[model samples]
Every structure is written in C-alpha cells, then in structure tokens.
Target: MEFKPDLAASNPSIDFTNELAQLLLFTGEVGVAIQQFSAYRGNLNNNFSFPSDIEEISQQPALDLMFLSDVISKVSGINRLIRGCIEINNYKELINYLNKTIELYKAYSRPNEQLKEALKGDPYKTFSNTYLKGFVDLDFAISILEAIISKCEQNNVGAKTA
Candidate 1:
C-alpha cells in the first residue's frame, strides 16, 4: 500500500502523530536491516575463501554489492517518510521526538565516517565492510531528520505570531 500523509486534517496534533508514526516505522525498518546485514556479513566472513580453481577466480559472489543496494533502498524509504513528516504542522511533542531522533543519528555518524574513509578506494572492500551500509543509512536518516527538525522549529516560531 502507498503511504501518504493526511494533509487535510483539521487537528494538527493528529496529523503530527500520523507523521511521527510513519517515521518511527521506517526507523524500525532500518534497525532490522542493520541487524540482518550484520548477520549476513558474519556469515560471509566465516565462509569466505580464496578460489583454488582458475575458473572460480572470476566468479565471486556479489553478496556485498547486493547488501549495499538493499541498504540504499531502505534509506530511500526513510527519506520518503521524513518528507511526509515535514508536510505535517509543527507540534511540541513532534519536535521533542525529532530531537531524540537527531541525537540517535549523531551517534551513528562517527563510526560511519571512519569506515568510509578507511574503505575509500575499492567498491568491494567498502561494501564488504560490515558497518558501511549501516553508517550510510544512518547518515541519510540524520540529514533528513535534521532538516525536519529545522523546519519544525521555524514553523513553531512562525506559529506564535499575534
């Protein structure tokens, strides 16, 4: 089903709640993807072995590439959810939730940056690194959440006009 924000609600609180619920759902999806990626990486590492046959040398499995693509897709979904939330009117409770999400994103940034730098040259190495996809997802989520928080603050200020 296509998720669309309720744009015509007369009550701003209900609208904000709906938007927040969508954000929370996507955030939970990211969390699940992170866990699944971690498990897949661990399994890949344990089973990985250099090919002894010449024919097999050129046929490496594309697990890392596939995982990276999955992560990008999920992050894009989160971005859409953030955009939906941005359409909702500002409320104090929504701002508080956004602040907490911003903090969570901040925590996800440090390791992501370090890993990106460390794996800069090779696509395989970069994508194969366990934390890269998770970090990239976090970074995207953080950027979108920050934008929503800034917009919400502006809306809050403009709403107080006499």
Candidate 2:
C-alpha cells in the first residue's frame, strides 16, 4: 500500500467509526429485507420476471441457504477489515477496504429497491467528506501504492546490479 502523507495526517478514528456503523446498519437491514422479498416472491408461484439465475436459485431451499451464507461471509469479511484498520489507525487501508465493501454491496444490493434508493444519492461523496475529510482520492491512493511498489522493485534490481 502507498504511504499517503495526507492519509497519515487526517483523523481516521471518527470517520472510520461512522463508516463502519453505516455499513453494518445498512447491510443488516437491507440484506434481510432482500432475503425476505425473495422468499415472498418464491411463495407467490407466479412466474415473475426476476433474473434467470435468481429465479432458478429461489426454487431450491439449498440454493437460498447457500446464497444467504455467501452474503454473511462477505459482510463478515468487510466488518473484520474495517475493524482491523481502525485498530491500526490506517486511514488509507480503511478507505481501500471500504471501497471493496462498496463493490460487494453494489453486487448484492441491486435487487432491493430500498437499498437502491438509500444508496442512489451521492453516497460516495457523503462517505468521503465525512470519513476522509475531503483530502483523499481513493483511485489516486491506489495508483500511488502501485507506483511505490514499482519504485521499490526498481531499487531492488539496481542494488542487485551493483
């Protein structure tokens, strides 16, 4: 990961806490609602136009269990990463982890209308301003990390030649 001076300088404690809280609350509420909706839709016995994959999976109890298990695993992993970042006071790592969480949320959250609505408005900007204090660009941070790694590799090669 890159050593972002701004990431080191900004206060991560409050921002991380708020972000974590929001993620937990949002996922818990929205995930259950989505699952319940899926179950209800299955009970209706009418051929609703859900995605083919979802329709197939909804028919089998085993598949539904597996789907819920996968959701739990992803959410748990995200929570652990957020907490670990907070413990270490690593703002950059926290941002990276949050971005990953957002990606995962985007994947599973599409089916739920309420979740979609909640996340529709410039949620990323809200999160950035509240947690990162408007000082960091996550994409830039990732590029810096890559550059640092490349520089280190070049230095190692030069040392080998000398």
Candidate 3:
C-alpha cells in the first residue's frame, strides 16, 4: 500500500517519543527472551503428529513451535506499539528510531546455528523452525513506517518547490 503523508500527522493524544523509546527498549528484552527459549526444545515434543500440507512434506519443516515462545507475543505487542507511533509527523526522527529498531532485530533475529540445523531435520522430529518468525513480521512493520516517512518527505518537498 502507498504511504499517505496526510495521515502522518502527530496525534496530540499520544506521546510518540516515549512510545518509540519503549519499542526500542523492548527489542533487546525480546532478544534475550528468545535466547532463553532455546531451552524449550527439551520441553516440547519435537515430533509432528501429522502432515498438514506440501510445505510440511516437501520443506519438511517443523510446526514452528516458536508460536509457543513468549517472544512472539511480545514482539507482536511491540509491532502494535510501533504501528500506533506511525502517526507522528516527525518523519526524520521516526525513521531514525525505526532504523535503530531494525538494527536491533537484525542483531538478534538470526536463529542459532544449532537451532537452525534442528529445524532442518525431519519435520516430525522437531517442534520449531517452521512457520512463525517474529523478526520478519517486525521488519515488515518497520518497512511500512519507512515507506510512510519517504512519502512524507516527498510531499513536503514537493509542496515547498511548488
């Protein structure tokens, strides 16, 4: 979807600076939480009970037990918070915060080498490494915010030149 610059007005009801700051802070907490989930492999039954689709049979990936990971839920909350902050008119500052958040995700999103290999084995043998990746979802949200910033910049520039 195209970014609507007009919709990027700052909402008097919301304190975007604080909101963005909180999102930035939560990224690290989420990263640590995900790291802790590595121990969950021992608790979850890695074996898939049944084949659901081609991705299951062909890709042979696990059921993405990450859904059970609290990190996913927390990340979703962060995404929602970020979405709310998108209405801020400070495109430059918003973009800066977003880029910083993206960097944090990039630093933490890589599944450990051991977990990566585990996810590749028999789909039925593992409970994770399949579908849900919260980082990707977070990245999509940041990308949308970046697009909106770009559009806002364009609109303002065009208006000044005209």
Off by over 4 Å in 3: 1-89, 111-128, 134-136, 157-162
Best by lDDT: 1
Model 2, span 28-97: residue lDDT tens: 6435534543545455545554433454334433433443444446556655554554456443543454
Tens digits of per-residue lDDT, candidate 3, 1-162, equal: 455443335443222454445445545544543433344323433443333333422243223334224323544544443454455433444445545555544433454555446545332222233333433244444554455445545645211211
Q: Give stretches of model 1 more than 4 Å off.
A: 1-7, 12-90, 111-136, 157-162
Question: What's the true lDDT of residue 95 in model 3?
Answer: 46
TM-score of each prediction: 0.37, 0.36, 0.31
Model 1, 1-162: lDDT tens digits are 677655535434222344445456555655554444344434343445322331221222344444335444544554454445445543444445556655644543444655444544233443334544544455555655556556656655223211
Model 2 CA lDDT for position 117:
62
RMSD of 3: 12.2
Q: What pairs collide in candidate 1?
A: none
Worst 10 residues of 2 by lDDT: 153-162
| Per-model C-alpha RMSD | 10.5, 14.9, 12.2
TM-score of 1: 0.37
- Top-scoring candidate (TM-score): 1
Compared with the true structure, model 2 gives a TM-score of: 0.36
